[model samples]
Target: MSVRSTAFIPAVFKNLTFWVLIAIISGVLVGHFTPETGKGMKVVGDIFISIVKVFIAPIIFLTIVLGIGGMGDLRKVGRIGLKALLYFEVVTTFALGIGVAAAIIIRPGHISRAGLDINDASDYTSKAQQAFDWWEFFKTNITLQALILAIIVGIALNYFSQRERIVATLYKISGFVFKLLKLIMWLAPVGAFGGMAYTVGKFGLQSLLPLGKLMLTMYLTMAIFIFLILGAILRFYKIRIMDLIRYLKPELLIVLGTSSSEPALPNLIHKLERMGCSKPVVGLVVPTGYSFNLDGTSIYLSMSVIFLAQLYDVHLSFTQILTIVGLLMITSKGAAGVTGSGFVILASTMTAIHSIPMEGLGFIIGIDKFMSEARAVTNFMGNAVATIAISKNEGDFVDREHSLNIE
Candidate 1:
């Protein structure tokens, strides 16, 4: 082969996507064969996630502050924030509706509930029984709290006479943080390997069969939401969803392996900017979306609720279903930073409705880890597409032709 042609091959092999793919395959093998050793690999993933998280707060603060400060229009910042929130609501509502519809149609929980392992869900139920206070939620949710503080600081900086100097310093720091992120991301394959190995090793494939129907239904619903709903929105903007997904493959893999969208947050912010989203839109929308726009989490929440209702043979009225969707719209926003937020939200939703048994959560907790990958991947992609759409709407997106060609 010509040297030029051979050079492309080496670059392909060196690509992060290539390594992530290999790591995922190797992880499955190790998990399936040496389950005990694979289980111990959890620390590798945890360490990588911790390292990535160390930069999240700073990066978000700088990105939003710089994005808002540099925009030179406080009204535009408010407009973008409002628009992003509105967009998140409409899309996530659609996600919840679709999830409920899919569960109703598929009837994943229509079978016998016998032979299901039931854990003590008293902890979840007890917490769920408590009233959901916005004050409490704000106090507990670190991401939402950071986002609010960043916006205040960003808006305050807009009026500061010395804003330029501070913004410039933040930009320098942003550069350093992102550069550090680049170094941290090279460990992605190791993290992916460890995360996947531990999950499969600890849970085992057999554990999934009992709840396989629910798992499959959730995945199917998210796939439809992404390719159909999100895709149509992107098409309206002259962008291909598949192309965007292809562009975001590495980050998606990281989310898949980690089963938490968080590990990829910093990298996603940088990539979105590179893909032509204006910094302000990327900063404001992405972090906010983590809290406000959880399409994947919304879908999972609704479907799981419906699945449990069906599992317990508890028939819900149309009013009850609508109530479930409405409650989810609020509860889902509080999901971002809470540990076991999914189960907690599910428990809370059931408690409020007084329909499904909170005890039913025990039936699926074993497989929750497996299902979380779907939620994380869908949530990650939903936020990415939202950033692009919002940027394009605000006339902040650039390099349309060139960015569309990103492979």
Candidate 2:
């Protein structure tokens, strides 16, 4: 609650972020030392992520449709919605460019030594090739075309949602999501333990070394996006962004534990309301933001693609690279901020750019986790910024409370 409270922490000097960092570090350490336990630990993280996931679809639907439908004059949203969407696009595209540039310059993943498992990954080549094989997965995940279908379904549901009979049904569906979230969170402790143990068991501490730059860069960039980009936007509304951050603490922690942002939707809703944002606005902006404003995934898709290309010494003409970037921008939007979303888009990106073989994915498979931290942070910052931007433009900006003001 207070900086003094953070000072009382036994594990680190202070702060919630520090504690989560410690938890992650400890998990990684424990997971690596005992690779035999990695399987079980991985399950913990997976289960935790799954628990939060059940809430995603319903939350997205209710939040967006209600937010929009509740807007009595839809035309009034033109300025807010369009401007907010524009911000998401510009910021996310810049992030992707930064990632690609970073990868090309650093070549962080390419310095494989003689004794390194350059050849061992041969066993993993097929596994890697699968990443670029978008067609095979498109059939299974339903994330591609089905994603648009979900919007259509949401639209249809909203039409019925207006009638009394359908309103009751829609509310019932929302209730189901709440129940699912509860059932899953009940198992979080077990899941957290398992996930952390798995990280420690599998790679131990050694894995962190290779991914150090990526982890640090991602974290630092996330901070910049929040304090600078998001902060500047919030300041325009004369609201303290850190106050918003504080309100969303619960959801943020849940995201950290599971590395999945979807699970935190309900909490985000509750926080936004408490901060004086109208319920309809929170519902509409947040869910739609999940799909359209995934700033983090944009960066990751490009960074990883560039990283992999460099890792394998693949050459890309400027025209070829620009095509990949443009294609990725389309494919990466609306990507869920979950463990596998980056991979999903990567698979699609490779398909679009025939230059890279599907098997090329295996090169960085071992390091995706490190890359994910960066991606998740970006996604989180983007949504938070979008909510504020929309609220300001809609004349719904509320300055109810202040919890932190580091800037």
Candidate 3:
């Protein structure tokens, strides 16, 4: 590593992990204690997230092209991409199963306000009453979607690497964008803390209490997802998941505070590459994986469906839940990566089930806001584990002794 790169090692440890946690906790506490302060802090968070989103298109395009191009043989890279996606789908279903089991067993987030009349989710009624046109939704999130399609087209075009100066130029552009992203990423702590403070100031801890049980359950489930399931995967890969976490401490901290996982993309790719995941596997899987294989989203989909089902006294049959799971599998394919997207998917999912009233979403929307931090964090961790596991399976992994020495 260069002197400049070596210098960042200490800061990544000191500021990224522990200090970021302190900032997040303080913001939540302050937001809980003083709602207005939380509100103020929210503005900081919003601005920060906005800044990150401003670059999403380039980040997705470049990193993906670079990861794909690094494979040398586009055909082999495509095959690896397919295999990685299949693995993602299988694991995502497992996540769905875990969520279903948890929801059925514990039935967390049941509001006990009997004889109390709550408004059906009116705010999202627009979303529900709107037509269920997959085509429109497809068109909406089409930036990355389109880029993936283009990559497919390029594969068919199969212009040799020498002739395809396009790929070379894109690789250079991708490198430049990643560098710019890194420079801007230095401000991540500021953005994260500001976002956390805003979340606290606006919502207050009281807001969290409404969905406290649900959030706590999700958090616990997320812990189980990490330590038990992902831990096992890490062990299978002969990699310490904890070690990976340490490598990614800075990125995960930023994801936690801001509640948007996109900002972590550059770091995740670099870390996976360092871990000896082949560039093609890391590049293609990580970017496209953002869309298709969201384990965290899968878990939340099942849990939230049940949460709303009981919240409004709508008892769903076993078959209905099976259908909900099916719908989540389809819906998750096009799930949004924005902050509070779970609720949007929740809004859409509830509509698809045709049992839960549209207005029912309001019961949890207030509290759902707080839960997304864990959701985003878990989503990120799931992808990181996937990259490592796939690399191990593909024989691309670096030795743990070399990668996990922590510099």
Provide C-alpha RMSD values for all models, in order.
Answer: 2.1, 5.2, 4.1
lDDT of 1 by residue, 338-384 (tens): 22567777776777877677687787677777888888888898999
TM-score of 1: 0.94
Candidate 1 achieves a global lDDT of 0.85
Q: What is candidate 3's CA lDDT for residue 135?
A: 75
* lDDT (C-alpha) at residue 370 in model 1: 83
**All models: lDDT?**
0.85, 0.63, 0.74
Name the candidate that leads on TM-score. 1
Query: Which ten residues in a row are the worst by lDDT in model 1?
Result: 337-346
Models 1 onward score TM values of 0.94, 0.78, 0.89
What digit string (tens of lDDT, one per residue) describes model 2 on residues 1-407?
89887767664443444455455666766666667866567866786776566556556665555554445445544455676667767877776776677667766656553223333245445443443544654565432343445445545554554545554565677667766665555555455456566655754566556555655655665666668767887888776767767656645655665566666666666566666676656766676677668877876788778766775678888887788788877788736667767766776677667676666665455555556655665677578767767776767866554523221
* TM-score, model 2 to reference: 0.78
Regions more than 4 Å wrong, model 2: 1-26, 76-84, 104-110, 113-186, 240-243, 356-359, 403-407
- Please tell me which model should have the higher TM-score, number 1 or number 2: 1
Q: lDDT ranking from best to worst?
A: 1, 3, 2
